[model samples]
Target: MPSTDDLGSVVDAAVRARLDDSGQACDAAERFIVADDLYDGFVEKFTAALLDRRSGAPLSSVAAAGTLARQVAAAVAAGATLHTEGERRGAHFPAGVLTGLTTEHATARQELSGPAAMVFRAAGEADALRIANDTPYALGWYVFTTDSARAGRVAGGIEAGMAFVNGVGAEDAELPFGGVKRSGSGREPGRPGIEEFVGKKLVRTVA
Candidate 1:
């Protein structure tokens, strides 16, 4: 997936996805799996972008912010390195990035509910997919690549219900919005969502 040439746009889209709704959205991207070749550069740019662009908005409540701050602290206690702009104050949890986390870490499997990102260095495509699909929560997944075939293949391989390629904020009213696995079932705002409310009765009349 390192075939992605535009690092700037990818970083922008990634930050947008991670910070959306102050990282409270269930579908917001929580983990970033970067190919080994791009991992360092990606993390550097990503952390910078997060620090510079974060809206500094309060989460739902002060208690909610405290919970998120504790989550990040726990990750650090568990050996993950943290690169952050500022400490949590009130309901505004400043943007931070976590590195050196592995699939075995407890925080690796948990979702951060604030503007924080956990980055993993993947050896290649297979490793990337493994990290991406390892979680039980599969509401939304994102793939950034220049190759169309690779994009399709990676997107198809993702376990999430919705896969966004090369961009963020692609959700529309007409599109089905939902997740698979523990993220929840069924769709909304689309044909499938409509069917969820409909009752079907089987009637067979032989002529």
Candidate 2:
């Protein structure tokens, strides 16, 4: 099991990396732009929830929202890519202590709740699209995507060197695995895995 400190580092690293890849600059235009204040609020809240989950520190709705916003702002300043599924018409979150924070962006027609929905709505299309294209973190260090085009892009992405799109969940003895950028370097498994346990020797015959 990973330690809390290790997990925190992982979460922070992932968050920072995503923010950097978001491609959104922290200029006055972006900072003061009130066009999507509600959506922005939602994004901040959702980000906080995820961070809290990773850190084992459950944050209150209000606290999460504030933390999320601060984190996003910091991420934007540092350049991180945000990802979402886009908005849906009929989404709702369960009522709880965080209900206020949950439905803060509820419009008269649409009552937005759930973290996923909030993220989608807040990120909008452009940032969401950027995330879909740039997010390198996948399930268990494996790249996850159903789009071939996006898969190709991720394969060549500055952050991901090897991406497996819709692959099986088994590790093969003959296969290799590795990553690029912050993910890590070098390969493992199959011959590579064995090589790590042995020394390489080249033999020649002299006549």
Per-prediction TM-score, please?
0.95, 0.32
lDDT of 2 at 117: 18
Worst lDDT 10-window in candidate 1: 1-10
| Predicted candidate 1 versus true structure: per-residue lDDT over 152-207, tens digit per residue | 98999989999988888899988999999898999997898888899999999999
Scored against the true structure, residue 97 in model 2 reaches a CA lDDT of 11
User: What's the lDDT for candidate 2?
Assistant: 0.33
User: Which stretches of model 2 miss by more than 4 angstroms?
Assistant: 1-73, 76-161, 167-175, 181-184
What lDDT is reached at residue 37 by model 1?
Answer: 92
Position 140, candidate 2: lDDT: 26
TM-score of 2: 0.32
